[model samples]
Target: MHILNIGILAHVDAGKTSLTERLLFETGVIDRLGSVDEGSTQTDSGEIERRRGITIRTAVASFTLGDLRVNLVDTPGHADFVAEVERALGVLDGAVLVLSAVEGVQPHTRVLMKTLRRLRLPTLIFVNKIDRAGARERELLADIRRRLAPSCVPVNTVTGIGGRAAVTRPVGSTQEAAEILAERDDGLLELLVEGGTPSADLVRAALAGQCGDGVTYPVLFGSAITGQGVPELLDGIGTLLPAVSRSALPDEPARGAVFAIERGPSGEKVAYLRLRAGVLRVRETVVFHRGQNATYDGRLTALSVAGAPAQREAVTGDIVRVWGVPEIRVGDHLGGPGPAGQAHFTPPGLETVVRPRVPGQEPRLHAALLALAEQDPLIGTRTLAGGDTSVLLYGEVQKEVIGETLARDFGVEADFEPSRPVYFERPAGTGEAVEEIQRHGRNTFMATVGLRVDPAPPGSGVDYRREVDLGSLPPAFHRAIEDSVHLALREGPHGRPVTDVVVTLTRTGYSAPESVAADFRGRTPVVLARALRRAGTIVYEPCHRFEAEVPLETFGAVTASLAGAGAELRDTRRRDDTWVLAGEIPAAAVHEVELRLPGLSHGEGVWWSEAAGDRAVRQSTATR
Candidate 1:
């Protein structure tokens, strides 16, 4: 059977979950349809997700249709959970981007489209919610073409009252499809010149080629709630989308990428892997390669398809859940020996301290957060010396979800303090430090080390190199020095992660027979700290990129409001009597703008913000 690993993505309230439930029911995977409001869908199994009616994480389900087996990944729609979407995209062969005919294209819709195009994934656009009272399919399509992409060509259409009926016809016979193909495809042009209609197979073949190449996108219409156009949608997926070719010999070694990580009900770590080559079997040792030639090996104790019983083996193109791999992370690649590519997730510009609501669940809270961070790296955390913990956040919604998840999944209640912008410190000028051999105080192991700190170009993270002779120190002691240097820089002179700097070892003087290797470990960090303090540092604060749509009458007020929040306007465009404003602003002021938009625009305002990296703050002000 052909396997298709496809992901479903859309903006919040775009009926993505409803469409997923409909597909499962239509394909006979479920006996009845599940409601998104009730959150009883097969993919959304978390209690918090069910109660909130929002997808907080990515979920997967499998169903069979004819000779094809489709593994569908339901990704979160809210911008707060885009990390979930990023991880999902790594394992997919194709995608279905859902758009609401009522709401048209949205900010997240554009974001997802850009990522899909960048990754060159074959995509099908589903214009959903046609049964709604305000549905305007034509206008929505035009909006998609203008704002999203021009390659969006309709594959099916809906008619009748409330669009209760739908049908699909040969792509070659339709004027729109024929014209699109004839203009670009020589074979279709020759057929048109011969006064002959292209066969369904030929048209589908051409579409698969172009769509997979990212040159075209097929648009299908439907109301997922009423099940109208659903059957046609499923048929199109099975027929129009490309399938994985099974040409690998059975003896080839198995290779896969770990795209997601989660904890099972039994407290075992589960890694969701997309097998790309050969076959994987139980008890087989899988070698994972990560950054800097790191390798982790584990025996697969069990393997299973999404929500299914354990299996002894998984073939190529299968999304399998495996156990007994505790060291596996979200981006680890197994079998084939090379570092895997990582998903480009927007960094969290805001951060806040997370404290346990109860008195002494501190360890539990940190452990829970560490587990969560392993699953979604965007939710990174920092534990201070006094045991205080802070978590990075995309927005307040994500913060709330983290607290709710800890309570629901781990049975520990937690609360977050007011969020603040995260900052980074970088070296301002070149500096040097030399530590002389000493046998007093904390320097039990006598050693002498010299280091130079230099500024690096922006975005160049901390780099360390040594220029010492190998005979002076063993490789183990050299490694200890590098590790200590990294730990010391975690909280630099300005109390933030150090970036865009190089810490190099320039000199080392220690008696080969008198120096204890462990002593260098203790002195290395101290010397690096001295060097960093002398280097002087500058602070940079996080910034966000925003886009808003406001009525022309209120554009001035909105611009003034943004300006007050330390925003730098990038561009402004007029669209259908509405002014679209784009700019960059301090992340700390985003909430104030969100709160004031409703009253400023009489509830007709829509705006969204995403992390846009960071910028150096005023020289006189310091941020920690």
Candidate 2:
């Protein structure tokens, strides 16, 4: 049997979970169908996910479709959980993009479609909710072509009669398909020019082949709730989408990527692995490679698949939940010796300080949060000087959800302060600072180092180089200085994370009265701080780039609200009865704007924002 690792994705409330349930039921993977409304989904079993009726984490399930083992990943649709979507994208062989026919293409739909094309993943579009009163497949298709992608070709069309499923035609003979096929193939183009018709087998073969080539997309219409066109959808999954290639011989070494880290039912860390070569066996030690000359070895104690019993081994092209590897992290490569794949995620634009509601629970709260951070590294938690913990968030909803999850999962009641926009510090000028071992009286540490701080371009990030001769200082001492440089930059003079600067060691001298690596490492921070103080630093607040669609009558009010929030309007255009406003706004004001948008536009507005990096405004006088 072939293995198909697929992902179901879409905008929020587009029936992605509903479609997942339907697929599982149709394939006989479940004894009964589970409803998302009731929170009975096999994948969305988390308390927070069920309570909010939204998927915050990616969920996996398995099913069989015509002798094919389909490993399905159900991903969150809300833009707030884009990190979850990104992780799922890395392991998918194909995707099913669910769309609400009534709403057509949305902001997130466009975002996801762009990523799908960028990754060159074969995608099948499911126009869900066709049974609704105002669902128009034709108009939706046109909108998809104009806004999403031009390569979308319809494979099935819905014929609704009085809000009921009338029929669905297998759309084989169409001018659009013929044109797309002809454009891709010279023989088909020549035959079409000569007024020759291609057979059904030839057309189907061309369509299926081009889908995996990333140039063609297949569209299928159905109501997942009513099971309309689900069989055809299954057929499409089995036949249209490409399966994982069995290129690795059985004798090849084991290889896989860790896409997720989660605590299993027994409260132990479980590494969700996707094996691409060889086999993973129980009790066998696996090597994890994370690139920086870092490698960890852990034994696989147990292996299990979604919706399946525990297995002693998992073969090539399979996903398994492996236990006994507590050190495994997201993006770690197992068995194979190669650089870990980078996760595509935007940095958190908003940050909030989380405090324990109960007194003296700081340690527990910190440990719980640290564990959560390990599972979702994008969360970005930090420990402040006052022992308060700050967590980076995507939005207010995510903040609330994270707070609730902490209380429920870890029993740590917490409260969050008003969110602050995360800022980065950069050097405004260049200066040098020198530290001499003789300056410290009665101290045995013997090291002398001179470092220079220089300004770099906005996005250049922090860089360190050695300007002094190699033999001037012992290699251990030099290594300690380099390590201390990185630690010192974590919190700059302004108490913000530093970026866009270059720090170079200009001079190095060490006299060992009785010295160790710690001597050089310990004193390096003081010298680096002195240099940063002399160089001076500026704080830059992140800005969120926004695109809003508001009714024409509410345009003035919407623009006024945005202006009140320190937004800089970049462009404005009219789209039928609505106005499309594009601009950048202070990240600090995003939560306020989001709260007021629905009321301001009378629920007829749509807006989305993404991090626009940071721009320097003024010097930060505040210090931590």
Candidate 3:
């Protein structure tokens, strides 16, 4: 059977898990489909995920789709664990982007659709849960066009209304599919205008062009419940999506990165791998590394796909399980034969941070969190000194999933403290500040620093420059003191990552017959804090870039709201149907606009935001 790796992605509660169950049962892989509410889908194997009716981890299962062998990865739909989605995408040939017919385009929808487009993976939209009331196919379709790039086209239609959409191949040039093609090249447009239709060969060529440039998305309709359109959905997966030639696959070096790692029931460590350009066969010896250049060799004792051990070899585009690999980690790239090109496995952006909620189980909480983090690289969890822990996240739903997983997945209860992100304060135009230090010990390490801090443009990164004489203090004491300065500004006044800022140490004077422990330790914090106060530093604000479309009449309202949120209106343009606005706005003020913009547009709007540089250019949602 031909293998196809596909991802089921969507906004939360949009029936992504339900759709997975539907695919499993209809294919005869399961006796009966399990419900998310009932907490029994194979993909939702973790107790927390099942009880919460949400997906936090990415789970892969295999079953046949008629003539095709599909490895379906049911990804958490919430923005929280976008890491799982991004990690899973590395192994997928294409994706089935699921959506709720009732909800239409949403926040997560905008983000994932953009991601799918960027990766250039051929995508099929499965508008699920059409059987539910108020499931507006026409409205959602319109919104998709309004908010997304024009290449997204509906290839099939849902008949009989209520989400149980019937399938239709396509009729004429009037369909959305035509629009997807027309935007990419004019030859197809000419063919559509020429007569009835272009030859299938011509259309296939056009589709390829569209897919290559992220100019087209094939939209399919189906309902997971009623089993409507499931047949065509199965058939379409084989035909419309062309497989990359087997020979075309690269003969990569023996380098595999761990994207998802787990422990089997017998306490065996299993690493789920996406060969980031590599080769491995049975009994091949490889290194299990511990950070920088430290390692131990181990044979690949086992190999499998979707928990079913395989008889053959693992390849790129195949997600397989490997045994006997130790200290394997996400983002670890293994390549050899000269200087290696390190490939980073940066999963989708995270939006959730969680602290455990179980009683008297803090230590177990760290274990559970680390276990998940090892499996998914995107879940960055760090424990700071003073017993503070930090989790880098993408969104809210992921936060909840992490908490539930602590108690239910690994049997731990955790208490979450207020999250304090690393902060940075950058130069505000060479504003000068002072530092004075004296220790309580017999010899005090006193140093005065005339520092200038200037705000750098966003994304420029933190830069530290020393204007003072490097040899001013005793060699060892001076180095120790500068090190403290670096640590002092980690949590900028704003409580966020400090970026694009420059700190200059213009002057330094120190008295030091310094002792290592008492003198240096006592003076570091005092002088650092005093220096910060003297500079009168301003908080480095977070900036976001967003694309917006609204009725012409509402443009004024949109701009006004942006201004109220400390946004500088940057770009304005007109395209096929609506007006597009792009600009950089303070992240703190964005919550107001996000809540108000949809209301201003009468419930028809799309928004996506990421950290932007000092300068951001916003364009039409369909421009890309």
Candidate 4:
């Protein structure tokens, strides 16, 4: 047996917390398995995390199984709280993606699998809550194989559904394990040809290997509440998961960057750092910023592991607590105990701005929000207008949590406003546009520039290239054009930041040589602003793929509501007695649509949304 850094992930309310509880109790790690519904589980430690019935943050706990040490991270299953999972994965070697046998592959499930693939991690699947109505192991297993890695195979199955059932290791031997061994390895295929059974070690090795290659995954199932298959699940965990005990930073000064920073009620800041490539020792002075490498100015007050306070230093595999550091941030790299790679935790689909709703609390509110953004640098903050601010986040629950944290932790009750997502809009066809730059001065700076705007693919982001070779123009002159285009994009054509388009410069020259400073700086912005006004611009709001679970009868209403909101429907199907609606909606319309579905469906839908950014290739800017 060996130690493993494993994470428990799943769709919201798919019995993930229950499964973790069962593992703790049955493995003798805990005397009793507490209920999440009752707000008594060990892993759902925070009050906010518990009350939400979701793991808002990652929690690490240690358990012993035979000779193996299981360092488990119970993570949030919701998409908005995905940053929690990302930071958690940085510290994990393996994962347990729990699904409901009653409700198969879900959207969040897909997100987790993609994240796992991106991380190139070993994985085990658990189809829990089989006792629930509409349970279908075979169908769900097939869906898992299709949506996730093809290597997924159920190693265990419940002999009976739910509470009274016994667990059986379906992949037992040569004949029994055929379903799992077919595509495992070349040796496995040979063993099958010879009618031989590979040892359990061989299977584990093959799975680990395939996982390392991004090829396969091992899956199992059970009902966590009845304690069914609990021991076998624990056995599999000890057998297959990787060790975390020896995972430490190198034994010297290292760069550790913050992925998450949390403040407890006691006003202590806990920075979660990934040791990039060095060792951090206790009571050592370290740098708290990525750019200020020459100056290591913060002290390592203390280090803690597995939720307990300790004086020992931290290393790579160790995600420890470091206190007494001010101005430390989520993306800031630190050098002290260990060195860490430079990594930025940019939460996906960020709106790039955060605004406060309180009056006269602007500066204080802005200050606190900025601090929060600094702590979790993924929460990008920017001011698009003089009095308007935007705080970027991965999900709405985070928005709520952040608001609540501000209210409770910082004494500011700030409400959020709808964000205008950024898009780079361009014209569909190419054309030359001209404008005269008249700096009403001694010399009028009239400018004529050939500009072409073209449509780009969704999510390619904005790109500005000079079709005219830099060598054709003065070096300093060409650079000036690039600088001002940035300024123009930041403050759009009509004076609003542009979205969903690409702006390219074909040619530019001043009205006369004396009209310019002999450099393009004299005509850059004027030329840029000219082409921008002449080149047509269109508007594109942020789009998101959404999934909603509601009562069976509400499917039609959900579809209707989504269609009315200008969303493109993907799939609407029934899961047991519940309806799952899949579709794409403009980001601005989601909040309203999400709030109205349940009421519109006559209180039948328990709505939740997961939006992936869908930007248009090109569009003209709408009036601001």
Candidate 5:
């Protein structure tokens, strides 16, 4: 059977979870429809998720579509959990971008569509909430074309919109669909220009081909609450999206990625693996590649293919949950390397320290936070100079969720300190340092290390190289030095990660019998730190590119508000009664601006912002 892995994505409160429930009911996967407000949805099983009525994690469910088995991945729509969506995107064959007909295109919706197009994943747009008051069709489509994508074609028509009797009917071969296709196909455009109408079959073939190529997007109208136009949307999913079918050979090696990690009832790690090729069997050992030079091997103690029990083996295109790989992490490649699945989103720019409220539960709180980090790696945790632990966050909601989860799941109450912006240190100049093997008191270890630090272009991260010969020391010793270099750089002189720099091993010396890997690991950091201090470092604060649309009358107030938040305006334009302002702002001030925008414009303001890398901190305002 063909396997189709698709993700349901949208901005928060766009009825993404409700749509998932409706699809399950319409497909006969469930006997009764589950309500999000009633906390009965299958995808949102967590207590906090049910109470909050928001999806905080990606949920997996499957339904059969003819001969194809559809693995539907329902991802969180809230911007705080975008990392979950990013992980889900790596394993999907296609996606459904859901938007509310009332709210139209939102900030997060634009971000998701940009990423989907960047990955070239075939996508279908679902205009949900058609039965709600103030729902729109033609105007919303126009907004989508202007902001999201121009190739979006409505494949269905809505009637009695914005009322209880709202419904949609599938339309055959529309002129807009033909025109959208003609732009991409020269032959088709010539036929249309010559006054010849293409046959319905010809138009469909072109549409399917372009949609599969991720150029043309088909839009469908639906109301998940009332089940209006759901069947038509389901048909669009199976017909317009692509699926993969592969037969794995007996001797072929396994190739897949771990997109998510969950803890079972017994506290054992359960890894969600999407098999791209080859076969995986029970009790078979597999190698997980984390990066270029790190690998971990573990045997599969148990396996379940597509949530089916009694399945001993899994093949290509199957999403299986495997046990016994405790070291496995999200984004780890299983068996052998194929695509690296690079991160599509930025890391959290804000961090806060958390302390156990009861004082004696420090260890428990630390252990629980580590487990949470294992599940969502982007919520990175680190121990501060004090005993408190700090966690990275996208927004305040995630921080709240973490505190609640610790109390509920781990039975540990925690208090979070006010959040602060996470910063980075970049090398300001070139410098070198050397420590001879037991020659000086500073070099206590039996290994000598020499290193140089130089700045690279922004966003290049850390690059490690060797100026010394490969045979200068044993391979294990060299590996130890390289690993130590990366680990030590995690905290620089300013207590921030050092990035955009190159480190070279200038010299190496080790005794044949006395020198060990431990000696190199112990000595490398000291030398590298000295070199970094000599090179000096500059601090940079994360920034975001923002776009704000405000009522024309409130332009002065909005601009003043943005300026007060340290925003640098780039352009300003007038759109009817609204003014659009585009520029960059400090990530630290993003939340403040978002909160004040509505009040500044009397609830007529719209805002959108995305990570725009980092900028050098002004010397006058630099703080640790």
Candidate 6:
């Protein structure tokens, strides 16, 4: 049998979970359908998830279709949980992007579609909720084409839309389908130009091939609640999408990635691993690679592949859960190296300090936050000078969920301060510093180091280079210098994370027998810090690009609110009976603006924003 890993993605309330249930029921994987409102869906089993009716983590389930075994991954639709969606994207073969027929193209939907196209992942568009009031077809399709993609072709036609009796049927080969295919196929274009019609079989083959190549997308309309057009969707999944064949050589080494981490009932860590090659067996010790130049060996005590009988071994293309690797993290590679995981979206730009309401719970709260960070590394946690714990955040909803999770899972109640924007520091000028080995008895260390700091372009991050000969010191000593430089830069002269700078090792000297890696590690930070201080630093605040839609009557009040929140209006236009405002706003004020928008617009306003990088702040206004 073939294997295919597909992810279902959308904005919140687009019926993504509902669609998952419908797919499971249609495939006969479950005895009956489960509802998200009732919190009985198989994927959302967490107490917090059930209570909120939102997916905080990516969930995996399996079902069979003909000779194919589909490992369906259901990802959270909320923007705050976009980190989950980003991680799942690394392991998927294809994706189904769900859009609400009523909402048309939303902000998050546009973001997801942009990412899918960037990754060149084969995708299918499902315009769901067709049975709901105000649902649209022709107009929505035009909007999708204008905003999302132009290559999207409808494979089926919907009938009785916007009613409980809405349904869909396959629309055989049509002019649009032919034209879409011909856009990328020379043979098809030539046939069309010659007035020769291609057979339905030929057109279908061309469509499938192009779709798998990520050049064309097939759009299908359906109602996950009513099961309308669901059978057609099933057929599309089995026929239109590609199935991967993992036929690795018998001698091939194991290669896989850990996309998720979950704790067992007994609190042991369980890793969700997707093998791309070779085999992983029980009791076998495997090397796990975390980031660059870090590896740990752990034995697999148990293994279970999805949609298959219990076995001692799992092979390529298997989504298996393995035990005994407690040190594993999301995005870690197993066995050998593969493509480095890319960040599909900007990380959280705001952070909030969390304090235990109950005295003496600080220790437990820290530990629990650590565990949560392990699961979603993007929610970075740090300790402040006063011993408070702060966590990076995406929005207010995530903040609430974290509080709820801590109370329910760790038995600790906490209060979070108003979130503040996380800032960064950049080098202001070039500077050099040196720590010599036993020079005038001024240095105690046996190793000598010289570092130079220079400003780099924005968004370049930190770059480390060496101007000294590699033979001047052992490789271990060089590694120590590089690692310590990064660690020291974490707290720059102004106490903010430093970025967009180049640090170069300009000088090196070491005693033949007395020099050690520890000596270099201990001395390198001191030299780097001196260079940074001499260079000075400038602070920058993160910003977000925002779009606001408000009724014509409320436009004046909404604009006033935006101006009061430190926003810069870049464009303003009228869309029918509403006005659209587009601009950039400081990240710290985003939540406040969102809160005030509904009231200002009389509950008829919609707002969306995404990270727009950072801008320099005046020294007087910079947060220390």
Alpha carbon lDDT of each predicted model: 0.83, 0.83, 0.64, 0.67, 0.89, 0.90
- Residue-wise lDDT of candidate 6 within 541-589, one digit each (tens)? 9998888999999988999999999999999999999999999999999
- Tell me the tens digit of each residue's lDDT in model 2 across 212-293: 8777898898888888878889998998999975344757788888888888777999888788888778899878887544
> Which runs in model 5 stand beyond 4 Å of their true positions?
338-341, 428-433, 438-445, 454-460, 514-519, 533-536, 546-553, 571-582, 594-612, 620-623
- Largest TM-score belongs to which candidate? 6
Give all TM-scores, in the order shown: 0.89, 0.90, 0.69, 0.77, 0.94, 0.96
Error of 4 at 567 (Å): 1.6
Candidate 6: the clashing residue pairs are none
* Candidate 2: residue 43 lDDT (0-100): 78
Candidate 4 lDDT (Cα, whole model)?
0.67
Q: Give the clash count for each candidate.
A: 0, 0, 23, 46, 0, 0
Model 5's TM-score against the true structure: 0.94
lDDT per residue (tens digit) for residues 512-576 in model 5 = 79889999999999999999999998888888778899999999999998999889999999988
How well does model 6 score by local distance difference test? 0.90
Give stretches of model 1 more than 4 Å off: 160-175, 178-201, 246-251, 307-310, 336-341, 426-473, 500-510, 526-538
- Give the TM-score (vs. native) of candidate 6: 0.96
> Deviation in angstroms for 385 in model 2?
1.0
Top candidate, metric lDDT: 6
- Between candidates 1 and 3, which one is better according to TM-score? 1
* Candidate 6, residue 94: lDDT: 91
